[model samples]
Target: MSVYYFAGASIVAALCIMIVFKIHVDKLKHSPEQMGAILTKFFIGVAFCEVVPILLLVAGFATMQTGLEFNNLLLPLVCIFFSMIIAAVFIFLQTKVDVTQEMRGKVYTFAMIGLSLAISIPFFSLVGLLIQMQ
Candidate 1:
C-alpha cells in the first residue's frame, strides 16, 4: 500500500520536473534542429529513467505477491529488456518529431536534472524497501 503511494508520488514528481523543463525550454529561442536534438536527448533520458524504475517496481511488487519464490536475476533481466525496447521506441518517435547552442547547455542541464530526479526517487524507494526488510 505504502509502496504504491510512493510510486504515485514519484510519478507526480517526475511530471512536475518535466513541466519545469518544458517551461525553461520555452523561454529560450532555439532553431528547429536544435529543438529536435534537445528533445531527443531529453526523451531518451526520460524514457530510460522512467521505464527502468517503474518496471523494476512492478517486478518488485510481483515478487512480493509471490512470497519470494521468484529468481532474483529474472527481475533485472526483464527490466533491462523491456526498458531497452521502450527506449528504442521512444528514440524512434522523438526523431520523427519535427521541431539549441547555449540552448544545448540548457537542454543537457534540464535533461540531467530531470533524469536525476526521476531516477533518484525510485532509488530511494528501493533503499527504503531494503531498510524495511532489515
Candidate 2:
C-alpha cells in the first residue's frame, strides 16, 4: 500500500515537473529569456523535492539490507542521476517547439515515457521481495 502511494506520488511529482515546463513554455510567448531562467529554477526545485528524497530512500534501503553498505550507495545514485539527465534533455526539448496542435497529447506522451523509470525504479526494488513470497 505504501509502495503504491509512493509510486503514485512519484508519478504526480514527475507530472508537476512537466507542468512547470509547460507553464514556462507559455511564458516564452511573452519573454523568451524567461524560459532559461525558469528552467533553471525548475531543475533546482526538482533537486530539492525529487532528488533528495529519492537519495534518502536509497540510503534507508541500504540500512535495511544487512550486506548492503552505505558507502556503496553512491554508484546507483549516480546512475539514476545520469538517467534523469538524459530524460531531462527530452523534457527540455519538448519546450523548444512552439505550442502545437497536439500539445496535450505530446505532454502526456512525454510525461509517461520520461517518468516511467522515475516511478518504476524505486518500486522495482520491492519486486524481489514480492517474488520471494511465492
Candidate 3:
C-alpha cells in the first residue's frame, strides 16, 4: 500500500539525516565551538524541515474544516506544544554533554537520530494525511 511506502520512505529519510549528522560530527572534531555551531544549525535545519510542512498541513486542515471546532485545533496545537518540549529537552541534553569523548559522541549521535526521527515521523504522517485529503 501507499502507506507502507510512505512509512518506509520516512524511515529512510531519517536514517539519511542521521548519517549526515554523524559525518558532520566526525569532521568537526578539532574545534568544539565550530562543532556546537554546526550541530545547532543542523538541528534547526532538521526541525524546520520537519515542522514547517506540518504547520502548513495544519493550516490546510483548518481551512478545510468548516466548523470552528476545538477538536480540530487540538491535534496541531498539542503537536506544537509537545514538539517544543521535546526539542528543549534534546537541546538541554546535547549542551550538557562533552562531545569530545567517544562515548559522548555515540550518545550524541543516538540522540540526534532520535530527535530526527521524532520530528520526521510525525511530519511524514501529517504529509500522508494531507496527501490522502487530496
Q: Which candidate should be chosen as best, given TM-score against the real structure?
A: 1
| Per-residue lDDT of candidate 3, residues 37-132 (tens digit) | 766766675665455444544445444433344444445445544553555365435535456564465456546654655556546544554454
Residue-level lDDT tens digits of model 1 in 1-134: 33443344345445544554454355333453366566666566555546655664554455442222224333433433343343334333332333224345544554455455544644554443443341
How much is the lDDT of residue 131 in candidate 2? 28
Give the worst 10-residue stretch by lDDT in candidate 3.
1-10
Q: How displaced is residue 130 in candidate 2, in Å?
A: 10
Root-mean-square deviation per candidate: 8.9, 10.1, 9.0
Cα lDDT for residue 52, candidate 1: 51
Candidate 1's C-alpha runs over 4 A off are: 29-99
Q: Between prediction 1 and prediction 2, which has the larger lDDT?
A: 2
Ranking by lDDT: 3, 2, 1
Clashing residue pairs in candidate 2 (N, C-alpha, C atoms within 3 angstroms): none
Looking at model 1, residue 59 earns an lDDT score of 49
> If candidate 1 were superposed on the true structure by all CA atoms, what would the RMSD be?
8.9
* TM-score of each predicted structure versus truth: 0.43, 0.38, 0.38
For residue 82, what is the lDDT in candidate 2? Answer: 48
Give the worst 10-residue stretch by lDDT in candidate 1. 91-100
How much lDDT does each candidate structure score?
0.45, 0.47, 0.49
